[model samples]
Target: MRIDPALRALRSNPDSQRIAQTALETCKSGWRSAEGNASIFAELIRYGRGDELGECPALSSLFADLDRAAALVEDLVSQILPQIAAHPLGQVPFRHQYSGGMAVLQLAAAGDAALSLVMYERSGDTPHSPTICFTDTERHEIALAGSGTMQIVRRNRGRRAPAELSVSSVEMKSGQNLSLCGMFETKRIESVEERLVILRLGRTGAAPEPSLEFRVADGELVHQASGDKRDSCHELMVSLLGRMGRCDAAPVLAEMTRSGSDHLRWQALRECLALDTATGFTALCGIARNPADTLSANAGSLRAQLIEAYPELAAFEKTLCLA
Candidate 1:
């Protein structure tokens, strides 16, 4: 395999190169081993009921080592990135990704512009703590070189309310990075990949520029508003809060139904239906009557899905959002 030019250059510093090689190998070994054992872990989980997981020593030990291995590799990566930035990347754009249970790295380039990512799977110490109710927080930091824009969105499809997803952004200098943080309730076991951050870079002014701008056309991934307890209401949050049986969230759901993003409006309507079918279906009928391009399309798809799932919801499809 042809070594990355940047990696080849990194090799110049003997000690730094050694650290990078060792970290990469260790991370790879642990991730592969975890993947191999995943099926066995899942099987063991199904063996019994409440105490089966905590009772298994193998499961507990494996989770502990995976957490340790990821932290070690993450530290090594932190050490290497600063060195790479000290020396400017070459004009050649490249993309490299390394995925493990606890972390994943994505690097892509287009001539003068490049995007590199280090995603960590936020892990908890007690994988056996499903017995108790608790909350966990997550945060992300992104570094960009040259010029670009970034969008950070948080979506919750679980029982807890969505924390109003912040539309905050930051400008980056050649060596600077941006960090954003927020907290969410962790009442249930959520997918490790739930947190998403998309980084977009300005075109490098090269001919036939790559589509460097980030896009999220798929509306189905819509998350409820961020229910940060203290943050301002985000429209999506209305539905999830309602799901928790908070009647005070009803008016919030009403406001969310009028959002410009039809994707959001539709989801809000779904929440309304669960809360008060008459009013929610009424809003749905109104939206369907006058649909736009992307938003309307999302509304229609969701309408079909809901109707299919609950045949009675079919009555509301034509009368609700799409009309």
Candidate 2:
């Protein structure tokens, strides 16, 4: 019979050790869940002091869940980003594209294990907390991409939506104490007990995500949703893929610079520079002679920058190279 030091401290603490187990259950349900995440997270952070939840070996299971979830998100991005960018609509518009919460993937056949999302409000009978997990696994690999808004809930079955995410991290502290996000944005009674409820969140420079995401099961489009948002998402992916130096993205960038959407020609040209300088230069030459001042000026400006770096482009001084 043996007990870990961290677990021992949690149990002996006057507050309560059950709080740790509760938080573990919360993680089990899924961090994506809407269940009073903002408040529960705060509690976990406050009570996780010492070995209670921080160093307690008993709570290892919960930590494992967190790690696995993170890996899932990372893998999804790495595998599906290229696929999304390769969509036909992905190459035209640059800064603008549709994001209809769609997903394109490579499937084995059908019914392979897959990941999807369900956004249900706190209606009666529905689970009060948001939940996310693998629905099926009949395929070889799984991946996904997109954005979705996660509600920050105050009450378990809160009808009003205004929940924010936060955390505390002793392992990754910046200066003196654990960092947090979207916390203390409300007026609530202050108590050491209440503060102990939050999770120890750390700082991140991540940007905002979309309001909906689609899973890429196989090498095909699954789920049924596509509109401006999805198209926009695709276009953004195309531009991003070009920047990633994906040679496969060259054709798309070149095409965009040639006959794509008029408003996005500049973006296509920019991507082409990275993917195919020849095509990009040709596009610039065409724009350089156009009547539109903005279009011609932009081409001239970009040409100047390129010329400074690539003296070889200076050979085109007689054509499109800026003085």
Candidate 3:
């Protein structure tokens, strides 16, 4: 493999201590150049052993320097490995390629114990191919680099609400790829609901992103709203009901019509007529047949408009019509 100028400079340095210090600092800073760091470490090990470079006073110092650099690298890995292993997105094997090389790491959590990690490395211009691994007797495959994006998907099977399960996606850094995606379901479950959370971390210049979804039975979709405000889901549902008659959203319209709130009842009445003729007509019949019920004035006006627009509502209008 060809060495970059930065790697070449670190390899040729006469002072091993300075070279090792720089390597430690780069790793500490979470450097974007993984290939460069790996190359420098490989060279440092070769020189420290006095195999690649002739013996000299610097060789003894090089050994100590290399040791310190290796320790730092191990420390950095130790701290990050646990977090990656526990991450829902990190549970899968992932691989990515950049201009120089690629890395593949498989992650798994061992019951309450430490995480299990298996890492692979390769260098070249071509992308890495997909690989497979097993966890809890199940097998999964990781995608080839530059194929499509990888995501973590969670499915709930128990009698709990759909919102109880969570799913998410994470993006790998350039030259870094995801090698596997796995599915995990807990056996020792809890009663509290769960939501899908996706965590994405990119290269140093790239921003981290996350997406969440809450699903309920009967095709109810609740999207998270922007800002720190609480109750966004309920707020969004209310806003959607307000603009009903304009869109063909039958589920939410049905929900609004069944709502006990008078405001929601009025909104649903206006939107239902534009949704579907059969369903809208049936809803109007229910209101006309129960004119004594406390429906808002707006709801009543909408009923009147339905009669005027569709003469079919004329018979029920007599029963609901008030002087």
Off by over 4 Å in 2: 1-231, 259-263, 316-323
Candidate 3: what lDDT?
0.38
Instruction: Name the candidate that leads on lDDT.
Output: 1
Candidate 3, residues 1-323, lDDT tens digits: the string is 89886556656774654544444444434532354444433443444333322332332232234343333345557655554443322222223322322232322122211112222233223332222111221221221222223344444434354334443555432233232212222111111111111111111101111122333223223442222122235445645654554455655665656554444454555566666655565666566556565763445676677678878767654544551
> What are the Cα lDDT values of the candidates?
0.42, 0.38, 0.38
For model 1, residues 93-197, the per-residue Cα lDDT tens digits are 224454442233433232333323443343434243212212222222332223333334433424333222223344433333333222221112233333332
Deviation of model 1 at 261, angstroms: 3.6
Q: Quote model 1's TM-score.
A: 0.27
Write down the worst ten-residue block by lDDT for model 2: 134-143
User: Model 2, residue 225: what's the lDDT?
Assistant: 24
How do all models score by TM-score? 0.27, 0.27, 0.23
Q: What lDDT score is found at residue 54 in candidate 1?
A: 42
RMSD to truth, every model: 20.0, 22.9, 22.0
